[model samples]
Structure formats: structure tokens, C-alpha cells
Target: MEIDWIWGLLGGLLIGSGGAVYLLANGRIMGASGIIGGLVDGSGHATGGERLSFLAGVVTLPFLLTLMFGAVATHITGNLAVLVIAGLLVGIGTRLANGCTSGHGVCGISRLSLRGLVATCIYIAAGVFTVVLFRHLLGIV
Candidate 1:
């Protein structure tokens, strides 16, 4: 296997463990989508300052990681409009689903949640369908 695979696996393990710890300690779910949505909507129990800090940490962590490791982040060589549209779609989907892949696929699956199982299935199906539609049907690959 490649070194990148090892790193990916380790990172996933760390994230999953951290999420489990958060759930256990705080009696809260570690759903990134939910956290972001709550932060934006200001509907969650967390205070404004706490939400801002949490959101800031989420947004800054990737940059900090890249800086500390001297690793260049992957760049998408696609049209800017496509990227923006895709991002917006993903954000909307996450909000509608109440969580993202990390939340449902990892945390929810680990806890044997029915909603998580269904959500993860839908996420995978949507991803596969999108790839097929764009690359095969639309010849956009």
C-alpha cells in the first residue's frame, strides 16, 4: 500500500476516536454538518462565542495542518463555476441530510444508528451516481 493510504487511515482513526470521545464526554453528536448548520443558524444550545470558535477551528485546522507539515493541498483543476456549484450543492445536501459523510459514515455507523445507516447509504449512492452521470453520461470527466 502507499504511504498516503496509511496516513489517510491514521487520520480517519484519529477523527473517529475523537468523535467518540466527544460523544461520550459531552453527550453530543460529533456531526460536522450539524455543527456547521447550527453555527450558521444559531439554533443550537452552544453560545455565539463557542460556535464561532468551533467554526473557526474547523475552517483553520486544514490550513494549520498543511502549514505544519509543509504539505501542499490538492488543487482542483476544474472550472471555477463548477466548483462553486458543487460546493453549494454539497452544503445544501448536508443540511437536508442533517450530517455529512464523516458524521453518518463514521460516528453514526459505529453507534449502529438506523438514520446514520440510511444516510450513509444515500451519501454513497449519490456520490456514485454523480460520478457516473458526470463522467460517463455527460462525458465531463
Candidate 2:
């Protein structure tokens, strides 16, 4: 069968639960970029174990799922240059915003944070604009 809303619902619940657990257990926001950034910038050494464990779960769980359910192709472009440029752009955007969608959209909104709400709005708008501009207008993506 094709994808269904139930999978999305389950994923959302899992993400929200994980964010809540991380916040309650660590007393800190669970931003994926921030977690990895701390390691790259040497600022998260104090909590390196937690970060590493979280990262491990993030990577491993998806592989386990794919193993059980079969591979789900993203159908993304295989061009290395395009992929690298996209990665760099994402990193720059994430840094400029001070957080990613998970940080602002999930954790921040959950706590009624104004910044999070605003950030999430901006993120969604930007994503929509990008898709329209690239896929529809320019036909470049």
C-alpha cells in the first residue's frame, strides 16, 4: 500500500514524545542541529554522551525501519554537486535562523514560545516559496 496518514500521525507523536522526553530529562531544548553542532563546535562535550546516543538512535532507527519495511526511495537527484550545495545551504539557513524546524516548530511551539511560533511560520513560508520558485516557476529542481 502507498503511504497513509497513520504513518504521519505516528511519526508526529514519536517526534513530539521524544522532544518532550529530552526536554524533561535534560532541561534543554532538543534541537537536532544544536545537538550535532555542539559536537562539531566542541561546545557539547559536557553532554557528549547524550548527544551521541541521540544521534545514534536517529540514524539507526530509520535503517531498522527500512530493513523491516523495505527501502523507500526519495527519488532525489544523484548529482553530488547539487547535493553538497543543498547541504551547505541548509546548514547556512539553520545557522541563520538559530534553530531548525524541529527546534522552532516542535519544541518551541509546544511551550508557547513566540519566537518558535514566528520561526515556524517563516520556515513553512520559505519552504513553500522555494518549491514554487524552483519546481513551478523556474522548473529547475
Candidate 3:
């Protein structure tokens, strides 16, 4: 209904298509969270230079986009502690699960992997429960 919604959909489509293309062409899934986690852990799969470049791209792309488009980004006014904790939790979860949402939900699902299906279901359920718990039960948004 809104222009923002259309833009968001277009962005999602581009991301999904790019991810699929990357996977098909390179045989590597494009999962940002997993990539960052791997870089932090230094798991021997990705080199230091590669990891740093990936991190830089992830961090700087948004700024570059904003600079080019002159769009006002939404400010996330929240406690830094909460944000850090949430990021840590997500990092741990992805490590434990062996993949992040984009890896399992998009790449895995497209490949018809059973593990991906189950992981995606659990991911959605957990996300829903978290939202309900925080917004309704705890009265926090």
C-alpha cells in the first residue's frame, strides 16, 4: 500500500535473487550473520583479509547507499546494552544452529533440505514468541 512497502519488497527480492545466484554460481550461501560469526571465531574457513572485506562491505554498504540516495534512515533509539545482548544472542544461536535465517530459510528451503525446513519453522516460531513476549507480556517494544 505504501511506497516504503514496495521498496522493501523490491529490496527483499533483490537480496533473495542475489543470494540464489551466489549459491548457484559459487556454491556458497550468502548469510551475513553466519559470515560475521565465522569471522569472529576464526574458524579457518575464511581468511582474515576476506573476512575483513566482507565485514567492511556489510558495514559500509548502508552508508554508501544513504549517501547516494540521500534518504533519511530510521534511527534505532534503544539502549546499547540491549542491542549488544541481542546481537550476542543471535551470534550464539546461529553458531549453535549451524546456520542463520537467510542460510536456512532462503537457500536451504530452495534446495528442499529437511533440516532447513525445520530450522526455518523454529526460527519463525521463536521470532513470533519473542515479539509477543516482549510487546504484550513484558509491555516493551
Candidate 4:
């Protein structure tokens, strides 16, 4: 029996819970872009250690999960240029949107923020359009 849905559901729960806990503990919105951006621009110097710890958990937890449950097939492309371009695009989009999917879709929506809702909608629409264009029209992605 496949446990894909189970894993996804659990991941969602964990993410939601983490956001809630972060909000309660830090009194700040749990936006990945904001956290990293502040650190990169030195605006969050006071919270640099906190941000580093959060990022460490973000990178480490997945590795630990794979170590415990074995690796899962991601079907990622092997092309380094494509990967770099994709990462750059994502970073740019996150900057433009002022948040990421986790920040707007999860935390912002949960808090019923209008800006978050609107940004989430726009990004989702853009994502759908991109997939349709690249996958169907251009056969790129």
C-alpha cells in the first residue's frame, strides 16, 4: 500500500504546527523568504542565530527523514544549469511576492491576511500558467 498521502498529510500537519509554534514563540510571521532575506541583507543581525538554527532544521530534518525512512524518488532533472535557473527564478519570485508559498499560503492564510491571500492567489495562478506554457505549449518543464 502506498503511503504517499499519509506522508503528505503528516508533513502538512507538521508545517502548520511549526508555523503556529514559531508565531507563538517569536511573535513574528514564519516566512521563509523574510527569514533568509533578513539574514542575507544583515537586517536580522540580532536574530541571525535564530534564523541559522531554523534554516539548519529545514535542511537537516529532511536528511534525517531520508536516513530513517530511506530515500524517495524525486525525479529531479540532472541538468545543473536548469536547476540553477530554477532556483534563481524561485528566489526572484519570492522577493517579488514578499513571501513564499509556506509563508503566504500557510501562515498568512491561516491568519486571514488580505495581502497574503492575494499574493497566494497570484502565485498559484502564475504557477499554473507556467506549467501550462512550459509543459504543454513549449515542452520545456
lDDT of each: 0.80, 0.87, 0.78, 0.88
| TM-score attained by model 3 | 0.82
How many pairs collide in each candidate, listed in order?
0, 0, 0, 0
Candidate 3's displacement at residue 26, Å, is 3.1
Per-residue CA lDDT of model 2 for 16-103, tens digit only, reads 9999899888887889888888888887899999999999999999999999999989999887877898899878777677788889
Clashing pairs in 1: none
Candidate 2: where are CA atoms >4 Å away? 1-3
The TM-scores of all predictions, comma-separated, are 0.84, 0.90, 0.82, 0.90
lDDT of 1: 0.80
Q: How far in Å is the alpha carbon of 4 misplaced in model 1?
A: 2.5
Query: lDDT by residue for model 4 over 1-141, one digit each (tens)?
Result: 599899799999999988888889988778999889888778889999889988999999999989999997899988798799889988888877879988898998988999899999998998899889988998877
Error of 4 at 52 (Å): 0.4
Query: What is every candidate's alpha-carbon RMSD to the true fold?
Result: 2.2, 1.7, 2.3, 1.7
Candidate 4 contains a number of clashing pairs equal to 0
| Predicted candidate 3 versus true structure: per-residue lDDT over 44-106, tens digit per residue | 365556556656876798889889988775766487876887788888898888778788887
lDDT of 3 at 1: 45
**How well does candidate 2 score on lDDT at residue 7?**
86
Q: Alpha carbon lDDT of residue 10, candidate 1?
A: 96
lDDT of 1 by residue, 1-141 (tens): 469999899998888876877678766677888877887777775555555665687779888988898877577747787788888998899988888987888888888999999999988998899889988999774
- Taking all chains together, the TM-score of candidate 4 against the true structure is 0.90
